[model samples]
Target: MNQVGSLIFLVALFLFSTFLNWYVFQAYKTVLSGVDSERSKQMLNLIYWIVFGGISIWVVYTFHQIFKAGEISTAHQQVLNVFLTIVVTQLVCTIFLFGEDIFRNIQAGFSLLVNGKSETSFPTRLKWLSIIAIAISMVPFTSFVYGITKGKYNFTVHREIIYFDDLPDAFDGFTITQLSDIHAGSFKNLDAVKKGVDLAIAQQSDLFVFTGDLVNHEAGEIEPMIDIFNKIKAPYGQFSIIGNHDYGDYVSWESPEAKAENFKKFIKQHERLGYKLLIDEHVVIEKDGQQITLVGVQNWGKGFQSKGDLTKAMEGVASENFKILLSHDPSHWDYEAKNEPRKIHLTLSGHTHGMQFGIETPLIKWSPVQYRYPNWAGLTAYQGRFLYVNRGFGFHAFSGRVGIWPEITVIELRKK
Candidate 1:
């Protein structure tokens, strides 16, 4: 955006944030009114100002750097993300308090109209409502704290049993473990990261496939975790494909040569991590006397990079083959894989990361990203072709995950 537009947007955000802080302060003052502990009240007041002051200073500093650089650095962006998480979560708590206040006001209005005397006078706070508000505020506060501390590395294995009528008896009960979007650059906790990697290794699936996104922007990011990633193994083999981030497209480079060099390094990093980097190529997995085709293409999506070539990948494969295609973005399944004449039985993807935050349970699953991508996560099918978008092995911009924890997907192939 232009400088004027950016400044205006920043000012508006600051105003809104200030208003929320004021609302929080007012509610807090009323809540602490009946309490006798002066020290508790003082501590609360100190916390309120410290958090607000820190956020304000962060905002000003971030905008100043953005204005000077004409773009935000990764560190600045991460700081903004962390700060916004706190601000937005607190704002949500404030909104709940406002709702309670509105309800109490309505009740008072009704009492005044009916009995000519309201239960409480104007500006009188309901102690119960205030208490409820405080309790409600702790929900997001605790949840966010958990997200930062434990949620990111809390890897869970999601298993799916998919059956096909085109029976390959030899391949029945075959297990394939998929891990995608290991944005190594964003990892901070080495021990926690190693724990997640260990979980993936423990699965012991017959085959392992890393759909895409080995690094966030450059290959060097994966250097530290090279040994940890190499621990992941399967009897059949481990294969991988490129994602948009692997190309180093998001950041500016000193020259075209540097960008090309970075891309080459990313390729080598995949090799170092023991992934048979496939680029618009096909491989056959043979077990006993049956065979299934596994094709991989470069990163492709409707709105993303268009380097993947399904036609090239499926060159020698027949239409009747039990093909499992690996393309990073789930959108590729919608636009190309499912529509291919040579039917792709299953497509693996992991670009969305379910926005790295959402409520996913057996009963109710929902994420904001669902509105943008039809095949956002989990198993989705179109015209009998299945697409499984792994929730991702790691996180990205947000740095932490909430309800949507890091995922390790294990798919068992059953012949119907």
Candidate 2:
């Protein structure tokens, strides 16, 4: 489903961005038609189209990243957006062109103060420079799209559930490493993924976990990073679960056999990486006679259908053991884990990679993802329950993280 949704998003953005580029091109042509010098106007118009065309593509890439998490209405008042964008874009271009003029004039004035007139004033060429600026404004976006095409890291959370800090007198300063939402096939190949894996190992975590999104759609994409993931050495072993991206629900398949084969290969890859893939199951990790029940379920969502069977996963677990959960989507922590019959003490998740971009500050930090999920990233404690959201190990297709760098959460579980 994740794979198909991503494709749908890409297609939608592709269409939408193409329409916007056409609009910009038309506007540029209209402006050029009225200019006194047709030849210069035509040259400037061509430049405008190229630059804005590139920008439209970059905007489309950003839209694609945001749309995959949920259904968004791109066409609602799109005509208005185009018109407004063109007007505002023109204004921006005019400001830059005029600002350059003002700066040059100021510089000339300074020279005149020292040497007088400097060199003939150069005459006013401001007539059509605004058009040139309008066209030139799109260059940055074009370069950005090219950058994304080169490579992007779409990583999931590392959902490690071991004790991190002062652990119940029985366990002490235990560290758990976690990752989530690794959209494997979304890009060409792994680049900085090894750095992420090595960073996870450097935390000296006791246990490691990967909560889901192991593949974009086809499980074979999981093969490339097996060796890198194997480097995540933990004393208690690594555990994992199926995220929405894991079930092969997105693309068409000729037969169940082919799909099963794809799924098996990914499973084998996870095994080779030394991870215990838990599907709606429980594992008991013991230390000093005290047991921590690690419950992992399939995917669950607030709006989307629940693929995870939370109840079934914890069926055989003892009531006395302290429970920790590995649920992919943050919504699971908000709705299910907190209110579960057994009542989980801590929950770990990674589906929201903070949408791979946003602003963070000492006073307050926020990502666009926060509007959807309550605890989008970082640690949240509520009603004595704890959830740690790993910002994630890699990025999505819009790869570069502005304020939120790709992260590997090293949680030191403290027993208070």
Candidate 3:
């Protein structure tokens, strides 16, 4: 947005946030009135400053960072830390306040019916209700704190065995490990990030594939982490495809030449990391006189960039050859890859990042992003074709992950 538009948006957000803080504080103060101890009053006052005052400071910091940097960069983690903390606390407090209001209205209605009076003696704020609100708010506060401190680095390995009826006999037990959306700009702790790369290295798969999104906006973002990523090795080799963010399309440039230069650097970074960058192309992997087709296309989605050409990538390959496609966005599987004339036995993707938060357990799995993209996370099949969307190897804008931890996916091929 332009400077004028950005200023208006900031002003509106500041006013709305100020009102929300006032509303929550008023609800908190109602409970303070019932306590008579001087020590208790001082403790409550301290709590108010810590919660409400912290939020106000974060608002100022966010605005300052946006103005100075022109966007939210990796340098603004401290601001985001406060933002996540206050949002969860306010939501829980608001819910309790709503319940208290409902109870108060019910009491006043009963009094009017029995005594023919419109008034009642019920306290304006019940101490018990306020205590409940504070206690409930703690749950989310603790969880988010953990998410910021540890969850982002808690890389989980997901292993799956995909069986195919048309598999090549020479490649029966071939294993492939996939990582996606490194978003190298978002990484902060190099040691912690190294541990994740080490985990992928320990797998010792025959082939490794990084689906897309090597950097957030520019190639310079991955400079520091380039050596760390170079540690990933496999016997066959590593391959990659481009994602929307790798094109540097979201950020503004001084000139079209500058943007083109940045893209050139992006390709150079991939080559330095030993990844065979594919742009709407295909490669043949041969083992003991048996070959399988590996097709890769540029970032393509229903509403986003549609640069992928399935036909061009599959030009010379025979339809009978078992094929594995690497696509960045899962939407491609639903819209194009699945319905294409030539059959793609399996596709590897990672773009959604599970929205970086959700409830994912053995019994149930859900994330808000599901509403936008139906084939969001994990393994999904359509008419004997499979699509595995890696959760992601790193995070983006939010600076941290919640229940949906970062992932390294390992898929084993079995000939049926």
Best by TM-score: 3
Supply candidate 3's per-residue lDDT for 304.
80
Candidate 3: 10-residue stretch with minimal lDDT? 114-123
lDDT of 1 by residue, 147-201 (tens): 7768888899999999888848999999999999998888878888899888888
Sorting all predicted structures by lDDT, with the top scorer first, yields 3, 1, 2
Please report, in order, the local distance difference test score of every candidate based on alpha carbons.
0.85, 0.68, 0.87
Judged by whole-model lDDT over C-alpha atoms, candidate 2 comes out at 0.68
Which regions of candidate 1 are displaced past 4 Å? 1-5, 35-47, 63-81, 104-125
Task: Sort the predicted structures by TM-score, highest score first.
Answer: 3, 1, 2
Positional deviation of 414 in candidate 3, in angstroms? 1.8
lDDT by residue (tens digit), candidate 2, 1-416: 46787787768766765664564454456456666997898789778767766656665655564455332233322332343344445444545655766776887777677676645363343435546666676543443343344323433333334433324566566677787776666434555677566666777888888888887677777677777778777898899888776777766677999989988877777788788998889998888877788898888878754889988999988665677899888898888788876768888888787876555677888877889987998887777678888776554444444456566777666655
Model 1 clash count equals 0
Candidate 3 per-residue lDDT over residues 201-311, each given as its tens digit = 999999999999998889899999889999898888899999988999877788999999999999999999999998899999989999888899999987888888888
Better of 2 and 3 by lDDT: 3
lDDT of 3 at 311: 86
RMSD of each: 3.4, 10.0, 2.8
lDDT of 1: 0.85
- Choose 1 or 2, whichever is better by lDDT: 1
In Å, residue 223's CA in model 3 sits off its true spot by 1.8
